[model samples]
Target: MIRITDNEFDKLASYIQANYGIFLKKEKQALVTGRLQAELVQNGFKNFSEYFEYILADTSGSAVTAMINKITTNHTFFMRESEHFDFFQSEVLPFLHSTVRNNDLRIWSAGCSSGEEPYTLAMILDEYFGNEKGTWDTKVLATDISTKVLDTAKSGIYSNDKVGTMPTHFRAKYFRRMDEKSSVIHDKIRNEVIFGKFNLMEERFPFKKKFHVIFCRNVMIYFDEKTKTELVNKFYDFLEPGGYLFIGHSESLNRETTRFSYVKPALYRKK
Candidate 1:
């Protein structure tokens, strides 16, 4: 593996933070080195500096996508933070069903890694609406920076271990067996999620319509307080009044600094 010098590391770290809002602390230098070293050597780049320069010049965008895919951590599984789903079903769904006038429900999995989180949302929406699902437009917009994971998500196939975390009935109802070791999401569930590539650090969010519920769980953990605060504020702007935001259980926002009302642990409301 090729070594990344301190100069290269700083340059790469700053680029990631500036463009993606992921703050790589000094301690993460080794992690940066390890994740990227093999790729750098294999691609015939002697150092991180040369690779980044090529990434900047590549207009087709594949190179940038590759670097983000390897650098960003995408570890997540089905039904992660189950209580949030529980609340979404029992409390949130009922409210949206009653309140939303046009039968269009907007749900966004902002950092939907490998389709697990958005798939879970689609499944929950599927069960809740049932026959009524046909009348309402309940597509969940799932976006991530990594095109590699988005490709995996679009495929809607998962290894047995990833699907194993869900309940048996969930397994039987929403997924079909692909093989001995994998499962493919059923068409009903898969069609409900629209995956796209998005970067949170973009100067402006491009959505014209606001969402009723946004699930950006576990993603803000990679960002620092300033970045986190800025992104949270942007989330606030794009949500309709009375909409809910659910974040990772491990992450929190300062009530004193944020516009969102504290609803529960890792859950906030736009009042």
Candidate 2:
């Protein structure tokens, strides 16, 4: 593997942070180099610095997209964080039931890697609505920066180990056996999620309608304080006044920086 020099590491890390707000700390040098090696070699680059310049010169932005896809971590699975789903069902949905007009619920799973979180949400929505599902528009807008994971999310196929973490009833209800080792999400649940490629660092969010709930869990951990603050405020603006925002249990919002009212650890509400 080609070794990444400090200068090369700084350049790539700075570019990724500036463009995507994903803070690659100094300690991640080996990780960055290792993950990017195959891409660098496949593109005919012998060194990190050369590949860095080529990425910058590629004006179409596809190179950077591919770079991020290679470098970003997208390790997530079904029901990875069960408590948030429980809260979404018990507290958030009831509020929406009383307040939402047209029986329409717009939820976004930002950084929805490989579909588990949004798929889980979709299943909960399916179960919540039951026979009345057809009468409501409850589609989930699931987005991730990586096209690789978005493709996986769209396909809705997973190893048995990943999807098996959910309840037995849920497993039986929403998934079909693909083989001895994997399963595919049922089309009924699969169609409820709309996956797209999104960059959270965009200067402006492009959505005509605001969301009732936004699940941006575990994503902001990569961001610096300023970037996380800006993104949280953007999420606040895009969420309805009373909507909820769920972050990873390990992540938190500073009371001094955000308008979101802290409801619990890693959970907040716009007021």
Candidate 3:
């Protein structure tokens, strides 16, 4: 195991937290060092300290963004926790259709890595509404901190392995096989989602309108308690009243500060 010194870890953590909202914990030193080793070597730094100095000196450079992307985990897949999709289609959509005057329903796939989650949501929405495309405006806003992942997401191409977990019929309906081992999201469904590069640490979300549902699954595990509390509160503020927030199955908000009431385990609704 490559050991990261305390000073080295602190420097990297501060840099990451300042640039991105991600908080590196003491236990993650080894993981950070391992993941960023190549970058360090590529930049011609002998150790973490030298690399830290270089990044600190050039705080506004792409190096900071690249470092955050490398260190943050982006592991995600289609239909991850199928229950959430079921809830969205059966429970959330109907509620929105009846309550909101406009047929438009906006959902935010926060920390949407490599496009799987947002695409999955798009497919579900397409199936739910059938051919009534003109009657309703349904779209997904997918954002992530990693430009690398967002670039791949914009291409709408994925290897067979990435789609292995999706149902065969749905895959056939929404995706076209690009080649022997790859597939691309069909244009109809692909056009319904907008992908952008966003850092969650920003105090203000750029959108003027509030989202009806926000899926921020599996991204909070990297943050500490203070960061998690602040993020949960921010999500609450960004969501419309009675809107839903879906977090990772393993993550929970500090109940006192968050106005969201628990609807399901790991799921909350803005009060």
Clash count of each predicted structure: 0, 0, 0
Q: Is candidate 1 or candidate 3 better by TM-score?
A: 1
lDDT of 2 at 190: 94
Q: What RMSD does each model have against the real structure? A: 1.0, 1.0, 1.8
Candidate 2 displacement at residue 114 in angstroms:
0.6
Better of 1 and 3 by lDDT: 1
lDDT, residue 65, candidate 2: 83
| lDDT value for model 1 | 0.92
User: How much is 14 displaced in model 1, in angstroms?
Assistant: 0.6
Q: Candidate 3: what lDDT?
A: 0.86
Per-candidate TM-scores read 0.97, 0.98, 0.94
Q: After superposition, how far is residue 178 of candidate 2 from its true place, in Å?
A: 1.2
* TM-score attained by model 2: 0.98
Which residue ranges in model 3 land beyond 4 Å of their true spot? Answer: 1-3
Tens-digit lDDT track for model 1 on 94-115? 9999999799899999999899
The 0-to-1 C-alpha lDDT of every candidate, in the order given, reads 0.92, 0.93, 0.86
Per-residue CA lDDT of candidate 2, range 69-170, in tens? 888999887887788999999889888978998988999999999999999999999998889889899999999999999999999999999877989999
